[model samples]
Target: MYIDGALTDGQGRIDVINPATEDSVATVAAAGFADVERALAAARDAFPGWAATPIAERQRWMRRLRDEVIANEDDLRACVHHEMGKPWAQTEEDWDRVVASLDFYAEEIARLQDFSLPDRAGTHSHRMVWEPAGVAVAFLAWNFPLLNLAFKLGPAMAAGCPIIIRPSNETPISAYAIGELCAGIGLPRGVVQVLATETYAAADALSASTIPAVLTMIGSTETGKHVIRTGATSIKKYAMELGGNAPVLVFDDADLDLAADVVCGVKFSNAGQICVSPNRVYVQRSVLQAFTDRAVARARAARVGFDRDDDITTGPLINARAFDRIKGLVDRAVAEGATLLAGGDRPQGMNRGHFLAPTVLGDVTETMDVYRDETFGPIVSIIPFDTEDDLLRQANDCGQGGLTAYVFTRDLARAEGYAAALRYGEVQINGVKYDIDLPHGGIGYAGVGHDCSYLALHDYLVLKRITRARDTTLFESVNA
Candidate 1:
């Protein structure tokens, strides 16, 4: 753990284990308020000089940090495999996201330096300048720990703000390793720190700080709301990338095979623990049967096993808690009129790990439990829609508007209409690659639009309009 430019011991420690094999990976110190205060004070003290540093110099350190990540790619891959239980094959892509995030910050730093503000026609001259806030308190979940961390930390660093991160206890090794690399890159002693803990002690203290500015959190919708309320005292800026139930819309004109293939890839990528993973899939009636059959076959073909095992498509849920929630959701959905098309049981022969068989359900309705909630697992619900208009209506019907709807269609007009009507922050059309540069947040219950766009850099920085009179003498005479 790090506090005030140094490593400090916490009151308690917790052991990190691989959920797949129950092997002891590492241990991290779980700190309290005292530790958080030290880090806060250091960040507060360093804020001015950091924000004052020239943009070129700041960008230099950011690029170095990126190089450090590239250097340690292998180490990061192995750590992610053991701690997160993601397939070994996926680790490389995960690492690429981290690198891409750093690269994004590098470009942003240059753009920030060159960006000019709109000038008022006459009178006083003005320039828009972005300045860093004091300290950012970042909390990461277990899934895609590094990838999610990069989304916040990259901009925070580019804006010259110090950050204090609390990675999930279940999957902290890769984050810990990345922290070490960041330190090696020399991000100003206290620029970026990580506290791997069991409880939310560090976050609690950081939220309650007296510092005028703080950016709090990355977690569930409930947790994000809690942080917002607690941070009201300091009136800190809140940047939350909370929970999402991203919907996948398969229209009648869609390529069934393509939709089925992409759906499986999206859902099972992180064992379906991703907040943005497709949770509720709505397929048009014309291709519903063929799509369901193909989806079921593809889901069944996914190789499920230990994370370390080669050629595995998916792994166990983060822990027993997630497994329980997923199981409960599946059970209740089946009871509420959803029929299991292919899988709905625990994976056979995996008695030791938290393994779940990839499940697909048919005849699902909007009223079903699975359709109404975000199931962070391999279980997917397929609902049939009669028309594209109806599909769009139902897709955006939920009170929770947090979604990244996937529309598969060759018809440009249909795709354009859905894209215009769909209320998600990001929409994937016909095998589009997910670009990190694009904005990737949600509306309503999903989140408050945090970290999907190039404009996200503004979240970590405050703008000032500096002004100068055309004539100092005239201004002085009027003021005096």
Candidate 2:
């Protein structure tokens, strides 16, 4: 972990294993209780000066950090690839997001100026000002660590909040890589640091320390709950992007080929580890079989491998635990009478790492485990529905609020109706889109807070109201 512009050991160390090969890649030092406190203390020490920095200077640093990440893109890409088994191309896209975020926030800082409120009378005035919330911490999930870091880091820094990021032990190297980049840009010591904690005990202790006035995290819903429950003592504000069972609706009139190709491609991308990957596919009963056939063909044709082979469409799961967890979902779904239309086993002839075939389960029901829970792997549950009302009920019945809904329909009315009715943070009709401009966050259990937009900076800002009494002379005269 990088703390105060230096690399130091903490409680102990852990081996970062290559998920694809299940071989040790690196040994990363962990931040113990004392070390975490020192890191937090350093951030606290640096916060006032950094918060006082003019926005232009802050933006200059942001741009420099962005450029540093871009220049070291290859090294970062290799770290992400080796750490998480993501294909090189996918890692490149992640780095693209890293650069895009810095550029986006650096440009946006000048636009978020402090302002004064209207005065009620000539004697009284009110001014509204935004100030940094001191220190902040972001807990990252391993799947897209770099992108998630950008999600929190850019906005927090842009808002003038010093940050301490705790990367997932599963993929900790990339966080160190980012910390080193910030150091290269000559960011004030402790303004940005990475806490590579090896144990849940250490991470929980650090987050619960009350030093960080603002907290942000991107991870599973259960994990988010734990963060909230444990970190409640400080009463610090939180921004979280938790678990998602992204639902896709394929209306009967939709183009079957386009819908099938995109749905299958997305569900299997990154082995379906993406929080917003379309998980439940509800097809109109009339075209269910046709769509299922097309989707099954797409799934069956997907290749799983170790590298970015032109033929590969999916990669290995993060680790053995992920592989087994997803495998159990498939097995239980099958045992409960769901038809395995395409894949339910490992790819043939190769069996070493955490690889699973792209799978499609047909005739799935709302009662199945696969339907009720997040698989978080290369699997999709397809259920046929005849009525729009029934489909809507099924779509909206997710236990939690963190969902992304997709609608594929040619009719304008149908599209608009579904768009308005879907209970998810983001809705995509006909095409998929995510960028720095749109606000992305969960509504209910998906967790609090948002990412990527100017709104993100609001999370790190503390609003202050300044009131001026200009008519003091009238009161003084009356008193005399």
Q: Which residue pairs overlap in candidate 2's backbone?
A: none
- Runs in model 1 deviating more than 4 A are 113-121, 307-310, 472-480
For residues 139-252, write the lDDT of model 1, one tens digit per residue.
787788787778877887788887887888887777777777766666687788887654675566677676737665567888888777777777677777777777888877
Best by lDDT: 2
lDDT of 2 by residue, 22-54 (tens): 999999888888888889899999998999999
What residue runs in model 2 are displaced by over 4 Å at the alpha carbon?
119-123, 470-480
**Per-prediction TM-score, please?**
0.93, 0.96
Clashing pairs in 1: 439-452, 439-453, 440-452
